[model samples]
Target: MTKDGVDTSGSGQQSGKPALHSVYSVNNILHKVQILDGVKVTYSSWVKLFILYAKGYKVSYHIDGTKPPAGTDPAYAKLCEIDAHVLQWIYGSISDDLLIRILETDSTTYEAWCRLENQFLNNKEARAVALEHEFTYLSLSKYESLDDYCQKLKDITTQLNDIGSTVNDQRLVLQLVRRLPVDYDTVGAYM
Candidate 1:
């Protein structure tokens, strides 16, 4: 041990462990997380996954704009470095088209996050209308299996709810029952 009792390990960390606020690299984000293709992603799901991802790196504050270090703070530079990594993750996790739309030179991570949220959530009325129509017309026969159809319905309902169009359980059940094929009429009657 050194004279002051600090670990003298060659690893450069106090106890050969990363500091609590270490600048994390973007490479650590998992590959299974889908790229945010505006059309394909149901925004809320992507946001949840991305938040969990950033939190894993102890950088969730960048996503939510909380507890940011001021310029005078000792950790400010480190936060900026980590924010750059967070920004890279955001830029890399989106489609080329979405990247083109949302990219801004010298933009902070919080700015990009808010812009992305606005992109998905701004046109609530239009999205809600379209989703409502889709939910009304969806049929089990259109999908390869009943599971796919139900999942689609659930996704539609979730998107609608995200946009402030609340779809209650009863309404969802009604839609599910109403769209059954003619062959399931007997079963539908029982439902």
Candidate 2:
């Protein structure tokens, strides 16, 4: 797998190694990850696999320091095994916030963001922050219950900020939380 620009054959083979030099743009990263032979990846497929891996799927590193997560949901496990190429494409450079935005969106918005992300990518504008802002606002506003909101956000290891809609007048998320407490376990985070 590629790291800071140099290729490292396997994880433990070299204690410290360089891969891709620096992190490429998200679209660039996607393009490189997409061509893995035998892996028919839609934007959603990448997102789903990314999520599963982020959530710590069991897998072994291959000779190239890349391998599919083992015993993934049967459906995805097959995809990962068939296409180890995607796993080789790592995102050591993307920010935690950008990753969180991708994780938080519903599947539909996730797809839309993929398209939008590519547009910026093609333009040579690494606008992950702008894209994430739009995505977070849309995701947070669509919730009917805190549980649903929390479910979408639970895997977000990165914290988000100031994501409320422009139409929203509240100055703090805790205020909004106190006003609508359908699920304390979920709402308590913001409070």
Candidate 3:
């Protein structure tokens, strides 16, 4: 046993030759990744984190459009196996209803991932409309502070940008001025 407690007697030899150290392990990667729960608002961030984690393990190609090579090459085969394993983990992570919505035709991990993005994250038109509606209807409650209201508006604008629409800074400033309570008319004019 080495100082780290890994048994070294069987560690080096594989097929009568010394083996190179394997860098990626599913257990290690999975331990750090959070399962997707099928919420559209959080899906983008979740996928980004998962991509970073998988890239650290050199397995990001499984979802990034690179096809696993065909044939009996040991490294290629191992990568393909890992890809399938990672894909299975992804499938297992999402809600059952969402999993069922994944098309039967999506034979690879990349295709399934794209399907989910299209279903949830790619509705730019709908998302923009919804955000516009929310912005139009937003009003500060009597109990809500000006800072809190401004933060809420900022968050909505950020969400709009994330979904491929951008609110101009001038428009946002105007909205803030227009939406203030009547009592703040003097303060609004000073700005």
Candidate 4:
């Protein structure tokens, strides 16, 4: 996982400090990492983990999606689209777990999930949940400092953890945040 001279931490930090929070973000990269049982992963279990994070944090959903009922109900459609993309990402990373979770969901929801899955199978970039414009707005250009980014990340992470989200790999997100070029200080991966 360590790239050439990538520092792993990607920056410097006080040694021997235990992590207070598991998830991290900078410019809303959405690494969706989770750390459990000492195993760290990024881009893995992203779908369910994202869903868990959203529900756990009470994050609002957007309506007006691309389908029937959802297409008609903008708010519900937006939520469905968001959920579907997240589910598709998670399914790609961990198909078995996603399938199991889908099987456990209501048949209607599962069917919706399949449609989302097909969309992803057809095109990867087409399902990108995080948009470039949105990312640019959140990044350092407007935010102005790493502190701002970390603070926002902390708020989001707090919400996700407090609500018992499904994230299974926290270290990945942490590492990605620390690697962010927003500042000179490098953050180490969780020990």
lDDT of each: 0.81, 0.37, 0.70, 0.40
lDDT of 4 by residue, 1-191 (tens): 14343334733223444332212222232444342110123222344565566454333131113343535675565555445544343344444543554443533334644543443333434322222223323444445676766554444333333333422346436533544663444443232
Instruction: State TM-scores per candidate.
Output: 0.81, 0.23, 0.62, 0.22
- Model 4, CA-based lDDT: 0.40
Compare the candidates by lDDT and give the number of the best one. Answer: 1
Q: Which stretches of candidate 3 lie over 4 Å from their true place?
A: 1-41, 92-97, 103-106, 142-155, 168-191
Error of 2 at 141 (Å): 5.2
The superposed Cα distance between candidate 3 and the true structure at residue 83, in angstroms, equals 1.2
lDDT of 3 by residue, 90-150 (tens): 6766667778888465367787888877766677899889888887667777326998788
Model 4 residue 64 CA deviation (Å) reads 20
Candidate 3 local accuracy as lDDT? 0.70
True lDDT of residue 149, candidate 2: 57
lDDT of 1 by residue, 1-191 (tens): 47664666743456445454444434554473588774457778788999887777677899887868679998798788888888888888888888988899999899999998888889899988888999999999899987888888888988888888999998997888799999878877887
Report per-prediction Cα RMSD to one decimal: 4.0, 16.2, 6.1, 22.4
C-alpha-based local distance difference test score of model 2: 0.37
Q: Please list the residue runs of candidate 1 whose C-alpha ends up more than 4 Å from where it truly belongs after superposition.
A: 1-32, 38-40
